[model samples]
Target chain A: MMHRIDAEALAYSYTSGQRVLDDVSTHVATGEVTGIIGPNGAGKSTLLQLLCGLLSPESGNVLLNKSPLEQYTDRERARLVAYMPQSVSPAFSLTVREVVALGRFPHLGPFGSLGTPDHEIVQDCLGQTETSHLATRDFLSLSGGERQRVLLASVLAQEPQLLLLDEPTSSLDLPHEAAFFRQLRTLSGRGLGIVVVTHDINMAAQFCDRLVLLGKDHRLVNQGGPSEVLQADILTDAYGSPLLVGEHPQTGGPFVTAPVGGI
Target chain B: MTLGNTRFLLLLGLVSCAVIFTCSIFIGTETLDLGQAWRELRSLTPLSEAPTLSILLMQRIPRTLAAFLAGGGLAVAGCAFQALLRNPLATPYTLGVASAGALGAWVAFLLADVTAAIPLLALLTSKQVMAFLFAGLDVFLVYLLAARRIHTSPAVLLLAGVTLGMLANAGIMFSRYLARPDRLVNMDRWLMGGVDVLGYQPVLLLAVGVIPCAAVLLLQAARYDQFAFGTTLAAGRGVNIGRLQTTTFFVGSLITAVIVSEVGPIGFVGLIIPHGVRLLTGPSHRLLMPLSIVAGGAFLCACDIVARRILPGETPIGIITTMVGGPVFLYLLVRRRFSDWNV
Candidate 1:
């Protein structure tokens, strides 16, 4: 494979003796969108952090491009994997352009100024993320959806082969959510591997090429195409509540909904 | 700002600072003619012949320079503290530099009283050395407390600093109670903060301390800009957060100690100047740092003029800064919150 990330039987626990993840294993290849879906506290966020090397695995290891993640320098690893965490409020009102330019830090040498080519790449990212018009606008003044797009543009500016997003659409409304996933699909088609931690099962089923469902005990319940993983029995077990699973009326993919009655 | 415009603004800022510096020397308590002063300055003449020259060289020049250095140094430290702590309310004094330095100075006074014969122990009596040591101790304590957390928040660090300051203030009070009543006058004078100048010695000492620290801070201006985003985001952008925070904390506090050693604790210049500069030049430290330094220096020098000349008597320079800066900063903060400027 051109680019692949693998985690082998990984585990982690916080200092308070609460286990966040246990013996989890997964692999994501380039040109695919992998959706990680589970109920709250299933260690979905923790797993994503481990995969991106933001948090080291406690008992196992993560391999990026066939090399142990710990072996790569921060600069080299950043160029290979760009991570966009949950939404953050900036301490100062930096312009969107200034915020996006920060993504070039890993690429630029010490005391290096942005050159013409770097500017072109930044502009390209802004355009792709549809934030070109907001370049001069203050980042703090933007709407939640717009802020997500600008921050995503910052991640894209790194030009990583793999993109890791945690709850990227958590703050987005319906239209923005759909548009964001469509953009992710477009990026995946363009040969960038995307791994997203999301709670919306219907959207995950609709967009993801593969889905990894984590159960309440922080172990993988199932991993397959969305059609196979989004079964009613598995959804109920993973979420600890009754869920209605059926075919999408328009897209012919698995669609999930919460049952009106109790579990 | 666009590149060309920012360059122009920076150049304009430097020129204005130069004009202010020159005018401050001439327009002090004794107004000396500029031409004669320039001739004397250029000639390097002996101080005994020209009375204006003697006062200018012996007193006003060094005093003005000290005011500028301390003001600029404090402002730069303030900007670094605000950025490093990610809090607008944070200043160089937030980490207890003033209180700790005061405590250290008190201890020095006590030691000087008890051990008048020992030369090495006598060295402890220098307010500068005592203040520096206590300031260093404060920083070390804060670092020790905050570094234990995996992701130390600004609030945590600020809390640690405030607690340390309160403790140091308590120590100073105890020392004052134990010492002779006559020595209380010296302690009180040091606490009031003045740009008292004898010759270039104090100015030289401040320069040797402030310049290198300010240079180190200026080099990190772009990184400071990145830190405006929260720490985690900045780290994802390739900044080594731990190293940046530690270096900035020590250097910023070092400059504060250097200034406090020279002129006690000059209140509000550090807090006021950075906020004012942000309004004028925006929050990018690359522009903000140099401008803050120059503007802070000029601001203090002008304030010292009012203290020496316009005030009824010899008012301490720190008093004038608080009197002027407190209201101006309050007005700016209120207006900024309502205006397009980000809080």
Candidate 2:
């Protein structure tokens, strides 16, 4: 029942030889939320992509369930790990229900239509992400927050053990952001491994069980509990700016904020 | 679009195609009524006496079938190409296969006298054979130009294709300049596009080339749906991007080559049928491929009917499709459903 993905000492560069990620390592485990938090150009999105096998690391390897990530076929890996990018703009028209139903394609038998059970699972995913109301609407017609929730429902329909998301809540308003984190916790409670990349350090502090913080130089700066990683000195060093860390008035968790000009 | 309507629309399209196919046989200028034609078909009367029946059995039937196959195949190929490139305007024509085919046929026409004198030119004797060969060459050249970057940038593939298309167009112009006047008229007529064959030979040729490739495109229907968002997202959903791209491009090109070689690169059907079908049904490829296939066949058959009956002498099918399909496509474009059109 314990599922984990371990990425070890991964390095990567684009077509140009300049490396974006170097000697970076992290892990995501079931029943816990892992957050990759960083400043701009910190390779957070690239790391998430590497973790989910979207991009192969130039040097180093990823292990899923103690087996090499490259060993799994596309369908096999898809059944285990689902990934959601920062945004989705479909060039073709599809309704919310249809897009969510697409996640079941890996599990279906060859030339199989969705059975009653598959439909039920799709319906359940829509409900879980609070996107049931938008199930019949065109995916392109929804607002950013609504589309994000619908996408979450769609990925959840894959029934993946490990879910990796890149900045899933970046465009969401405050209430929508809070609602999304609550949805993540509920999934984590049900023994799913959820890894999210985001710029919202305060939300990450509140929601993440483990934080992997990357600095501007695209190197891991800190990796630990929210209380340890959200410290003023650590935050200031990683983000390359002056920052203040305090306690949340409501949840009493770590709260990260920045000074407007100076302090 | 919902999954439920995919089957419904396909059935509707099939019935429409069937109706159009049957009506096309009746509407042509052949003098025989259906009753007399049926009697002639049943009886052992020689075709020498049954003039109307001969026209019906020999000319219209085969010609109508060829139109159906060419239209359906081109539309399916274009649909696959569009989805593969994620561009609405993409077709095999965009990739230079049609232009190369046109040049190949023109070259064959120009070299007709030289084919017997030179052994090597003997193999390229028929326009169909030469057209297919040059289309394959065009595909190979475009592949060579775009293969490395195609994974990261599909625009490179389109650029290579467009460049090749321009070169092939130049080749066609040079060949036309070299051709004799009689050959020029023949070449021009072929260029204009027609399904005026009198027997089953052309129909059989198109069937041999089209049926299997279009079947492959149909099999890849769901993968096309996954690709609508882009390659990375498609890969995340368990599609093998390499395999899908290969199948979409190669199979689509092969279908276009087959159709273009046989029918002289008929335009508008490949470019518009899929979009027109998307307007009627939604954008699901499962619905799009088969519906496009049937609707494309029907559209061409209707156009061919007009081509045959509207004038004292027959008009080219290409002209009718463009003349009719252009206004209809624009009407569909300006109409209600395209508000969701992204590609």
Candidate 3:
């Protein structure tokens, strides 16, 4: 079954009273991949966090399955909307398996002993993320790429219907970053709604079914399919730069590049 | 969370704690052999000529139990505070809560004779009420200054806490200097923490303070373990971050205050025992927390024995814990290096 989350005309500002996001609205549905793409200080991260109930918009409300997001308890919302942070600092030397098992907390009883089925799910997530070999290793000792994968596995253990990620591959090399997006595509194939915030516009154009382009003013510039939203004029206007859009010679897909000033 | 290894480790800890507890009860200034203890237990007379029975009933059991409960309480409080503060060096007193509580207790002793008209205040006594209030004041100030914002630097927290702690300690010293000559010895004894208590009052005092608070902490052990991943990530897993942090600070500080009022402000048990137990049990709080309690109890019991035997007169157990734990803490730091501490 498909699940949906909608945001009405949302606006938000930080505690310092600086307006960061304004009049933004979007919807994400299962079996589809959406990307929130923008330049620095565009509040893409803030918008994604609002969608996942991490931050409440000052003016608008988020709806999950036609009910207000705030109406649901934290555990209820968490069981459906799983969020993966950009980076994490492990306070203790927990094993990869232990870190993954924590995702089952919303499902566990008050006593919180992970039963065999919970362990099995954790093991499956590790296998799904291809980190099974590192399950017994220390989470803190892993390299940046490996740590992101492990953290992704931990988020997957939540069995969420809607997965919201904030720069999930920001630290990866090219191959690993592509691999991470491909993994997301596979998960979306299994009827999951995935929303990601990233700086890589061309990568989003290649992977996401829909693009929510945020402009320099932190407002929604455009929202539609990649072919409609990834035009040269919209790209340049959103990024405050002269970005040239063209076809990838290899894949015959949308390829975007920004012209450096000296060039 | 695997039961196999955890069960074995727990059983081993329990056995060691029990053995050491028995030895602690038996080894003291007046030694009673096992056979004599057995005979005393078998004796028919209630209080006649049974030195073993009197010593066991009057001295050893109470003293040992006091050490056990205080050590257990301090260790659990330390674990909770460390998790909340995200700093491994944090103890029950790191945020200055217990120091303020101790200073309140010292003043309460000076003002013991004053009668209060309020029934509730009179019932709980000035020392306990003052200790709790001052501990609360310390948390309020520390939270306002250092932890009101979650992302405050660790160096700021350390500086704020240690500076406030020094001020409270100075208050204690100033009061000590102005005190009458007759009160000097009493002030000196309390300044150095000890379990040289006699009778069941200390044990009862520690149990009253430690049991419920420790239970609250143990119940939140799994939640605290999730805190290792930091607040934002932990909250992503459905943890109510606000509730957890509030409970940890208040409950941990209250327990620290209770011990401070009862047996003076003992240190190092809170600072080092949890870290030592973490080495054995890894970082899972389910294992690290309870095991620290058992290990801490056994450790302090043993320390009491050493304190009794180290010199002709019993040195304060606080001196022994610092003497012993200081070296161990240094060794741990030297081996682990500054790289391990993100703060």
| Number of the predicted model whose lDDT against the real structure is largest | 3
Encode model 1's per-residue lDDT on A1-263: one tens digit a residue.
47989999999998788998999999988899999999899999999888878788888989998899889877788888888888776777888988888787779775536788889989999999999999999998899999999999998988889988999999899899999999999999999999999999888998999999998988888898999999999989988888988889998888999877775
Deviation from native of the Cα of residue A257 in model 3, angstroms = 1.7
Tens digits of per-residue lDDT, candidate 2, B1-343, equal: 4456666766777788889999887788754487887788789789998877888888878888998999899889889877876766566776788888888777777777878787766765677777877887887787666555634244566677778989998898888888787777877888888888878988998998889998888988878877766667678878888888777767776777667767786776876888878777777777778878888888888888888787657898877776765675456546644444563
Candidate 3 local lDDT, B1-343, one digit each (tens): 4579788889999999999899988888878776886787787557458777877887888889989998999899988888877777677666777788888887777666554666665656677777877777787677787556767776677678878888889988887877788988987898788887878877897898899999999988878877888877777777888899789878887888888888787777887888877777877777888899999899999989998875568888878887887786566546643233444
DockQ of every candidate structure: 0.43, 0.50, 0.54
In order of listing, the candidates' clash counts read 0, 0, 1
Kindly report which residue stretches of model 1 are placed more than 4 angstroms away from their true locations once superposed: B33-52, B113-133, B136-167, B332-343
Off by over 4 Å in 3: A260-263, B1-3, B33-51, B116-125, B144-154, B332-343
C-alpha lDDT score of every prediction, in listed order: 0.83, 0.82, 0.84
Residue A250 miss distance in model 3 (angstroms): 4.2
Model 2 ranges off by over 4 Å? A109-112, A259-263, B1-8, B33-54, B93-97, B111-167, B328-338
- DockQ (0 to 1) for model 3: 0.54
lDDT of 2 by residue, A19-78 (tens): 889898888899899999988998999999898888999999899999999999988999
Q: Could you give the DockQ of candidate 2?
A: 0.50
**Chain A TM-score of candidate 2 vs. true chain A:** 0.96
Ranking by lDDT: 3, 1, 2
